[model samples]
Target: MNAPVRRRRRRLPLNVLLGLGLATIVVAVAVLAPVIAPFDPMRMAAGPRLAAPSLAHLFGTDEFGRDLFSRVVRGAHLSLGIGLAAVVAGLAVGGLIGLVAAFAGRLVEAVLLRVIDLLYSFPDTLIALALVAFLGPGLVNATIAIAVSLVPFYARVAYSLAVAERAKPYVEAARLAGIGSGRLVRVHVMPNIGQSLIVMATLGFSSAILSAAGLSFLGLGVQPPSPEWGAILASGRNYITKAPWILIFPGLAICMTVLAFNLLGDSLRDLADPRRTAPQRAGA
Candidate 1:
């Protein structure tokens, strides 16, 4: 008589679930801004200037009398879009550079690593600020600056992970079997390193959003009249004492966006940890 084998299913952690839920809500808000927002985000006198939260204007009105809720909803597109675009750009370019350095000859690897190290020496924010200053202000340039600043981080992560995978017994076995370099990477290295890259990208997204917002706050990001979270915050700076709602709401939006992504990234890292998964595999 043979006993049946029960496949084990991993349950998501509570924090992960919460994080996913929050992130999903944020994405939905960004996607549905046109339909969900009660009034035009840019319309002047949507209500009384600097009105506080109420049923009529959920997040209240700005100093310019625009609906705070609508502006926040609309701003989500720009903020999230910049973060997403930067993360993708950084991940694609940096990940490719790292993969090449890992698999290429030692001379190539050394040169690439030195360049990465040089870039890594500066703080990411400083790099972004310098690039933005040089490129001039606006959404597109700000995104490019943030993406450039993020490259070293993803490059380092990808390089290390790929190197580790390359040294693995399975990868060595594949190489000895006369697999081509491209095929080897496609079959062995990439699958293993991919999850880590995704986790890093998730974490990096929060940083991108914060950077973009900071640049906008400094008047080096999305220009005026374009409903952006940081720009909204900037607009309210002078009205902090008189129209606290303006500052408070946008600040809260930024905080929520950052927090949601951070939580999601942390949860993903925990889920992907080998130590955490090992016990489940052993039990199964």
Candidate 2:
């Protein structure tokens, strides 16, 4: 018999690959910025103020003559940090509230739902802005505001998923077998919804980063002279006619990063649920 050829795996969408590649580059740049950047992110070049793209400064220099590339490089840390921290906070608050809402009687669900609704009433950016207004501007406060606002989203997602899982036959069987409420909820409900929770976290990360950067742009985030991407954008925006790269680079960075997570989340939605796979053909 002739030798059978192995089928090559299908190529992923070009956008997916590009997004992933860009994301990887951004991450590497962010993480290694300290070692890679030539000038201190804070260093102001007296002569290079508002300089455009050139050999000395790859991404060009801002109106203050601070190296735009270096600032953008360092700013990645602030943005990523806010996103990761906010998501972690969301996981803790939301996971607990969700667990309780799922198992507790109608009254508890009603109360949590009310709180969720109240939180949802405030637009996300507005809530963050208000909180920042009260707490005073800074990375920590901005992060807290973002995290608190995001908590309700995760809680609701967890609650709905848990409720669905609780109604499953296995859960009923466990209850009939005298499984305790705490253990039943923990053992049966959490595992089934874990994948969904992860998906939410990834999405939350992208949102949080964008929020943080936006806040920084408004001067409520990383603060002045720190070289955060948003702060850089804000500073360089006035000089857009002179040096557009300052705004362009950071803006693109934020856009690409957010898009990457979105694409990754979609891909993960497909991969995360094993049961979502198509039916297999019977062997001959």
Candidate 3:
């Protein structure tokens, strides 16, 4: 029962440690893109048109003779930046609204639940597309759009966690101890449900990244000349028959990165929610 925590404190799974290290490296590259990238990510090189992978031009040259490796590296910056920003924004807004409704009472909870239901009825992609269309194309606007799409998911998760936490005897004890509703919620409910909110946020980040990339692929996000992953894919898509590496490398990057985050979120969610391991942990 205590082994998991002991393991975490002493030594954890190599995969988990390696995954964190990889994520950190990707983020570092994204942050230090201008300093780290070898060539101008945006500049088209006339001498290297459609060149295959070589020491001088790693990851090959795209149709426009642009450095494929440099753009992909820099694009990590755009995808991850927008993803973290949107997911954090969603978590902040949604977690608060959820906590408020869950603690308020029947009247407020019912109304808030109904609003969340309405948001849920719409497909997430639809909302993102609509937001980008209405707000016009830009990185900030696209981030906001994706973030708005993710709000209902976290809101629902937090609301559920709060409801269960409030019914616990400890929460009842707190209420009886003359604690005000606001302070009690802050001290008690928020701490208890913070794990669930974090798990939800990690997933929302992956989704936000994928959606933002889709928007960029369609020419709605970050705009051209920014060297986003999706834009790189878009630029080389037509050359798929002749130079597959152009599209394949960037596509693989997006897919693998999204998959890694999804796997990581699943593991963390398992670690955080004890109820998920009731049978296994109890037996072990």
> lDDT by residue for model 2 over 112-131, one digit each (tens)?
88997787666677778888
TM values, all candidates = 0.90, 0.87, 0.88
Q: Kindly report which residue pairs in candidate 3 clash with one another.
A: none
> Model 1 scores what on Cα lDDT?
0.85
Q: Rank the candidates by TM-score, best first.
A: 1, 3, 2
Report the error of model 3 at residue 120, Å. Answer: 1.3
lDDT of 3 at 33: 83
* Worst ten in a row by lDDT for model 1: 275-284
By lDDT rank, best first, the candidates go: 1, 3, 2
Q: Least lDDT summed over 10 consecutive residues: which range in candidate 2?
A: 275-284
lDDT winner: 1
Number of backbone collisions per candidate: 0, 0, 0
Index of the highest-TM-score prediction: 1
Q: Could you give the C-alpha RMSD of every candidate to the true structure, in order shown?
A: 6.3, 7.1, 5.0
